[model samples]
Target: MTISTTSTIAADAADAMPPLYGLKVLDFTRVLAGPFCTAMLADAGAEVIKVEPFEGDDYRQMGLQVDGHSANFAFVNRGKRSVRLNLKQAGARDVIARLAGWADVVIENFKPGVADRLGIGYGALSALNPGLVYCSISGFGQSGPWAEQPAYDTVIQALSGLMDVTGDPAGAPTLVGESVADVAAGMFASWGVMAALWQRERTGRGRYLDVAMYDCLLSMMPTLVSRVMAGAPATRQGNRHANSAPFGAFHAADGLFVLAVANNRLFAKLAEVLGQPALASAPEFATNQDRKRQEAALARLIEDWASALPVQEAVRRLTEAGVPAAPVLSVAATVASDNAQARGLVVRQRPASGPAMCHVEQPVRFDAMPRGQTSAAPALGADTLAVLEALGFDAGAVNAMQQQGVI
Candidate 1:
């Protein structure tokens, strides 16, 4: 089972040197939030070891499959190694302890008390390696009234009042199409890890991180919450901005488009683009306050003009007129658009066992360089033996652990 270090593939010289190169992360996480956090670190060139149960991460079977691997899993797991271990097995504790000693960071998303019961909690591991940055992502943080209550994205969104301000004004509350809360928590957790690492460099000490989906989502509700704090009622305005006029979707001859005529200058440009330049000088629509009061009438006039033109023509005319506008696009259309390709926003990779796959590239750049090429997600336990050997385990020991179902 042991793999010789000499046989390990060396990194390509042509690839850009990643910012997190040589950082080692032990990822004791699965599903969305924790996986996403570690994935970002891995994308930055950390050597992330994803430790999973023998049956593999549940996300592996939750979404669309490509050659028997989940596309969802692939999206968040690329650029990492996988090591299978049954933490319930007595022998697995030793394996986890060893990996803990080697890792600079350990991130887990287990519900409260689970990690402690499994003996891989912060206290146990931090005792073994005090400089190890341990991050725990949970539904409601490590200590709270709802800490033990299970939660998913929708639940967090609803509880955080995000749903209350989403969707059409007259419609039932709607959950965001994507898992915003989970992704936010993941992003915050990654930021926390980096901050902790930076501080450790100065003080020679590691810290524990408690990231909560509820807290993250609530933090993102400043606009709505702040309004309420100022004694304003919270209400949904559909696609419209609460304080802006003509700042939402409109229909064209062929499809839907959006505009953001936030300032008088932009509103004037929009009026000129609509062939009603005099409307800009009209007292009823001359100022932002005036437009806000007559938004419905103004939107109707713009829509009447746009409804005569195709979405593309409408968008082109608006752009040329110096007004910000865009046609609403489907997910497929977005990925295929020239703008996406020009920005290098999508990446294509061919896995050893699956068809070529396309993924959204990390939306970050360093030194004017986009993220480096990423490897395909690993198959379950694909690098167990190699990782163990890299950890100094010999062939016989690896074989014994495997036979005992500890890895």
Candidate 2:
């Protein structure tokens, strides 16, 4: 089956130019980390050609589906084209080599040595295209004692000491709600790729990036890591801040709210907001360090006042008193909030063959360039023929390859 190239550029030509408008990315990523990295590039206007296996990305079948397309897949794979190639076949290497030659950057999250075994490792691709900024995302990086050990987000979270400091002090270790390790690795990989691209412009050469989920998660916990390194045992504070007093979730009349009394000033304001201004001057709460010593007492005092008021009212009173406070909003409430709408946080994109879908826009913004339009994640092999044609393959050749099950 042949697919048209009409959906290649989702954003209109008249829209503001994207930062990576002329950039070309060859994406051999499957799941969250690699796809998310490429998604950022694609959102910035890079032409990302996602090379998938013949059966498609495993993520496409792993989550809630809209018209048979996975919503999770859509969230991370938007604004990119999909080209399916059976890399196990002998004929597939040529296609990958051609794409590598055409690309400015290539990203993959294959297990260590898998790409090399397939003859498409950074060494091979950089040889074919000397200026390629290749990024390899993995569980434990290219060389490590645990490099060969298989890992998922939870595994990294466990090993990175993130889970150790996540839950209530008396509770079992808790996994964060989202895939923090995977997302962090993806974010860091994008940073590495961008830095490499910038460096390449000056040095006239490419570089390889080794981004590990474990390392990225470990890097994310600077405070916790430093504390542990300094001989402090890891402590789980749950919703409480490690070094701050009365800085955590508190129950209100209607629901939960969070307030941060980061300094003495904020604590004083919080005390005033709770209608007990004298508490700010109390010997136990006079200073942040003293308040930290009596955090349970402070929390009780604050909660006593907060529990009488609804979350919004408590938040408003705290705000008026110059204290930082906000209600705890669920995901649904957050997405529908006025702030979310005003900031264009949610976007709509239509896939080539499916109904329109909503996505969260990339967070970064450029003053000179308006946000680009969104595109739905492509169907498997949606751009196989088009990508092959772009690689100088004729329709007859593509047909022959298809007949041979190479794509």
Candidate 3:
């Protein structure tokens, strides 16, 4: 079997879209994980329809509500249409089943059994729509003992040892500033979706995906899990690699920045640049292992040395010396960066009032067509009628369905 990217319409179809133009996605995931996955798909030219319960996504209420919707919600949900549907309500399940039959993909983030209870599980969805790529995002795998437990990003970070690996070594272990688990899970889910889409072209069938936020975070555990597997207990080492020395952030004379000396060669170069070349050969810092053993003394020596030169000067000297170095950038500094502008990393759109919407570009770039943007996130149920009408529902039917709380 082969999955082909052929069009249902004629060649040079004038009313055409970009790649994935004919793909249709039904998004049932809420908050961060599911929404982000669908957003990426939508940005790639998929017709992603986000199905929210009549009460709408919790993200619509939480966080910063702007223009009658959450700013964060708007950021993730731009370029997608909203169709309000209460899956638990009478008449709603059939509508979703219909949507599933028409869709190429179905994304949901309910807990393990929640979808099955609602008759929207992958088993049911795939049965209704054989070609459906059903993606289930959760805290754990479907059959695990911990599958039923609820998990947020903070909990996931803690469970996956990411928390233990963050923060200052002496300070209490802390969660990364952002929701690392949700973001990673969303990215992994998107990866799975694209993989399934590619395979579907060959097999003429789709597969069910199980993405756990906890597992996603664990997959990104850096050296923590591997080291433990190799006989090292996970320990909290703030701002430092658990195994590498002189591979951490240091305070330079004027400011702070990171210096990642991945291997002994870089460490030796770093030492030489700091005018302490002898220390690179000193018994205490002779090798990565020995340097780790004398981490306190090594840090003291490096700090004392770096405290002499200005941060930019130190960075320029090290960079010129072929060392990996970077200045720590605050949010404001990042927003104003020339690199940010030159790379087109941020997209600024004009509005009549208030500040123009400054959006971060989708991280992925294709050598072909660049990304396109729609107006900001929809108002609650903003595209309800238009999307439904496109889906073959009459205006009267949609209004009645909304009144019955089946939307």
**Model 1 C-alpha lDDT per residue in residues 268-326, reported as the tens digit of each score:** 89889888889888998877878888988988998899888999999999998889999
Which structure is stronger by lDDT: 2 or 3?
2
Instruction: Give one clash count per candidate, in the order shown.
Output: 0, 0, 9
Residue-wise C-alpha lDDT for candidate 3, range 158-179, written one tens digit per residue: 8888787678767888889888
TM-score of candidate 2 versus the correct structure, residues matched by position: 0.95
Sorting all predicted structures by TM-score, with the top scorer first, yields: 2, 1, 3
Q: What is the TM-score of each candidate against the true structure?
A: 0.95, 0.95, 0.88
Candidate 2 residue runs with Cα over 4 Å from true position: 1-15
Task: Please state the error at residue 61 of candidate 2 in Å.
Answer: 0.4
Q: Score residue 180 of candidate 2 by CA lDDT.
A: 92
Error of 1 at 90 (Å): 0.9
Per TM-score, the best of the predicted structures is 2
Give me the displacement of residue 390 in model 1, in angstroms. Answer: 1.5
